[model samples]
Target: MLQSYNFALSVVLLNVIGPSLSNCSVNMALGMWQKLQIFLAFVQSCSNPFDIVCPHKSHVQFRTQVHCNSTRPQYMCLYDENKKQYTEVCVEEAETQREGYNTILRGGIDGVPCSTNNYQPFSHSSNTGGSCAIVKTSCNDEGQLLYDDGSSTTDRSCRCDYRVGYDYVTVPSNKCFCKPAIEDCSCYMKYCDVNQVLTQDYKCARVYKLTGIFDCPEVSGLGSKDIEKNKKMPSNATKTGIFFVQIDYYQNKDKTYHGILDLILGIAIGMIIASVVLLSTADILNVVRLKYSHNDVIHIVCNHVETVVLCSIELKCHLESTRHCKFIYWTKRINGDISTITSRTPGIHGSTVTYPSLTLDSPLIEDCGEYVCCAVYDYGRVCSPPIRLTVTGDVPSFSVDNELHNTDIGKPVSLFCKIYANPPCSNVVWKKYEDGQYTTIHSDSIDCSQTKYFTFTLNLDTFMESDSGYYFCYATNIVGTSKSKCITLSERKYAPTIEVDVDDNYCFNKINEDVSMPYTVSANPPCTSVVWKKKGDGTSTTIYSEKIASSPSKHITRSFKLVNLKEKQSGEYFCVATNEVGTTKSQSVLLYVAEAEDDDFSSDENRSTVTTLPHRRTRYHSCPSNWETDYYPIKRRSRLLS
Candidate 1:
């Protein structure tokens, strides 16, 4: 069996790899010792046929000449047909004795050597110098044999003492025999019991049979009495002269040996076909060398610049190609319009195309915008993502002065500083310095565009004394911060106040007579300068410096006089006063220079006698004549001209 298994293995290996090694001398290269080892392995695997047929008996010897080998010491007289003589052999080997008696039973019955109808009782004799007699055997109630002739024998025949692998059966002649038990008899019995024994009419009987053999027939209704017949036999003792009943067993058609082999072959063939297909597919794909074709990608980096920036755009193609490609750098405006960049364009080199840099010698705020790089190939044109270019600088210049500003109370004023920056100013703060301390007046974020300059203005709703201080404008951006020149702002303490006094609405003076208009000036600080002007014809005449007075009092009064009465001097007259804070003008008064009327009745000699018109005159005073006497009695004050 082992040799057959090895041969089958060799056949499978040859079927798999024989064609590849057909030209090789592998068999001739094997050593003699290896070949001898293989031959010895085959010889050792061969089985002895006698051991398989009669495993426990020594009668069938391979090398010995002994005729009978039995445990029984008794001798039996027998005839040997092969020897043609009456030979004395062991009781186990003798077939028959005289008087028609068989010492060795065949088929569990006593028989003569040559007689066809010889049936005699079986017996055994001891070799202890005693006469041999017929060994009496009796049957128990169950018809099992109980030997009373043996010295160590008991009458307990009802006990089934058979070996585990043997069973007792009753033959047709009412004789018992021990036989090897059938394996899986219950399964075979089930098959027959379902088909033949178990009828549709419900009549059934238990059956026993030996399956997978040719000679055994089915036996039915074998009871426990038959099983008890072989109970006394040893476990390893050989059973003979008994035939096992053959059962017509059922087999599953789907699980036959051929079906199992076909299933395995189908699986193996499918796996081989799958492996071949996979390898073929891999080879075909490797030969074809398929790949994806992609367009060129453009990259543009905007160089940061303080004064001048050199900007470049680069194009890279993922695939190698011999075709000519063109690259164009574009600039996008804030209004969403694209324009090609033609100046300073570079040439292409292999898979990369680098555009010549644009040099901004003095990049201004206008140089900042969105730029894009594009690659134009034979297939299509691809553009890079838009990038914003920013040309930033320090905070742009602004101008301011340290001049002082005086604003009146209850007036609105604005202090502003102009700032210019490239990226625009982010924050603006207005600070004030008062009493050696600085304070933030206002702070706010300013979004100044690149094209526009920002003006930070601090508004004062009502000017007050607290608003007087040194103010500055602080501007900041990404580059740096700057502060405007400080300017001092102060609230005007007093506005120039002027008052004009005249006796009448107009100045009435005869020819060659003079008329005077008095004006009062009041201010916190004394007036720095004063002017007197005529209202009519918008003429300003200079007043004599001696007429002006710097007064210690808060109010100062001055009078303007006409030396000669003239029609031009009769026009309206007013006084203007100015101080460090502001200027003010007094009310205008009309001065009339009149001509004297002549008498008709009298001659030049009688002109005196004629009615003389009252001397027309005008009086002007800064104070009442009564108050002048009460306040300045010690000094003679100027009185009204009457």
Candidate 2:
């Protein structure tokens, strides 16, 4: 088959085929050798267990995937969900997949299966069309990963698994209830199970979930003795805490209770009839909030480059309140002790009990840990929820060369991903993106393989029209993945090449004699036409013309003879091969048509000796298909036409 570029996968096969094409002949055996080699390799790579393989979204640029494995050897593989099997697609086929067709699944992507707990089966777009994709999944704060076995297409879902000690409750359960597993248990039944036991008071008791953090102290009412003292002296009354749960009565009952209760009831009744107000407010307030400044994420991951993080501390208070207060920062290193970052009293920019922002700035590696916000007041101190600030590294940033690449078919080309990242990128790989989706260009190896040139590169030994498109590099670290700007690239195709079998050779014969010249060519897309030209006196003249038949193998050699050679027929002759890529001419050979006969050389100054090669075959009809051969050269002076 002709070396057609498939848009599905941008594969570079010429590095392997380009060198081999040089030795093959465009004769009857055309490209048999190269074809056989390609077929065998393709069969070996895609034989079994591999399903549908997708090609690069755009092939204006292409690259080869590292060999997969011995059994299912391929650049990338896809599992057919419905078929429940892996279908092998050889590396070549994977690179040159057809565009706008062929659905490529991402189950067995990057030459391997997606991470069980990390990646979920997803779909993406290709060439502006929808196709299968493999994406990563994440869980939220109140979620738990109950099960994950690494399914490429199935996303692991978070389950609700509530725990007692680890969880919290706003109100402690003073009373506990039981829901029996017995199907016949009555919903209205308030009795304990048969295995349950009652307390000393003949009451059933059970443990309840622990309260979240801490609870405020309960209020205690005044003692009976104190109430009696107050009642004895009607004018000596003082405020005392009261609680409804602590009411006491009988025997030494204080008559003051009756008087107070009657008075309170009278006031409550009058209030319901518009004697009192229904609104209340508290003035004491202390609120604290902490977060990183805009785009500052040293609080996320460590970075090799110099970095900074502004921990913005927000204190909520009333407006117009300017209470100068001390602002303190703290740092807790990983697996280390917490240390205070001393600070001076910040000139309060707003009113006390008002919202004001306090900021702490630093790039210290020790600034990675949980944080607490505290707002001190005359009455007390209030603290906010803890926040963990990690400074492991910053998200990576990089750039691409975006240089233009121009080349013809059967030629080699290379592209590089010149990028700069902080904390250095843990992994960098090429990817083809189209229609809001990206296709990985390499199989992640042990830590992922690195392409050479500028540290990361994509080399295409050879590609076709389909191998033209946009490509870019993707970098990743512990922080996250970063995408570089895409570059538009194209690999121009060219025509086949023609060359003379022997260089600087001349064919001489007397006028009216016949001369046979051999011309050899190596072409792709099979040269559609051939022409013979003789360059004489500053101009080129076509001496022979013929249409060449297309062939799978166009590396050919042909011999054409000029009968009854005339003086004008003598010149430099060369062969031209034309294909879709372009046209190329072979090396020129000198052709001399002389007026003197063989015997006229005996005339003194112009006389020359005639030497014959006894082992050599006769000339005039000698034409060999092979261009790469061992042929001795003869000097033009005193050399006979052979």
- Name the candidate that leads on TM-score: 2
Candidate 2 regions off by >4 Å?
1-395, 402-415, 420-424, 430-472, 482-497, 502-504, 509-515, 522-529, 535-540, 546-556, 563-572, 576-642
Error of 1 at 205 (Å): 99
CA RMSD of all predictions? 38.1, 39.6
lDDT of 2 by residue, 1-642 (tens): 011111001112221112122222212122332343344335424433222233333421231234344453434334455565434344422332332222444543232333332332333322221232333233222212222232455543322112101111121231121111111111111233332212212233221111111222211211111111111111111111110111111122345654554465445334422311121111101111111111111121212222333323322222121243322232222454433222332322321223322233433345556543333322212334345555444556665665567666667777766655445566788787767877777733324323212346787767665666777777775456787777666654457776655324656566766555666667656778888777867888666677766576657776666655567766677878888878887777877676854443333342123334457432222123233332222223123223
lDDT of 2: 0.40
Clashes of each: 6, 44
Instruction: Quote model 2's TM-score.
Output: 0.28
lDDT of 1 by residue, 152-229 (tens): 211112111121112233322211222112111110111222212221111232211111122222122222123323
| TM-score of each candidate structure, all chains considered together | 0.25, 0.28
Each model's lDDT comes to 0.42, 0.40
The lowest-lDDT stretch of 10 consecutive residues in candidate 2 is 280-289
**TM-score (C-alpha) between model 1 and the true structure:** 0.25
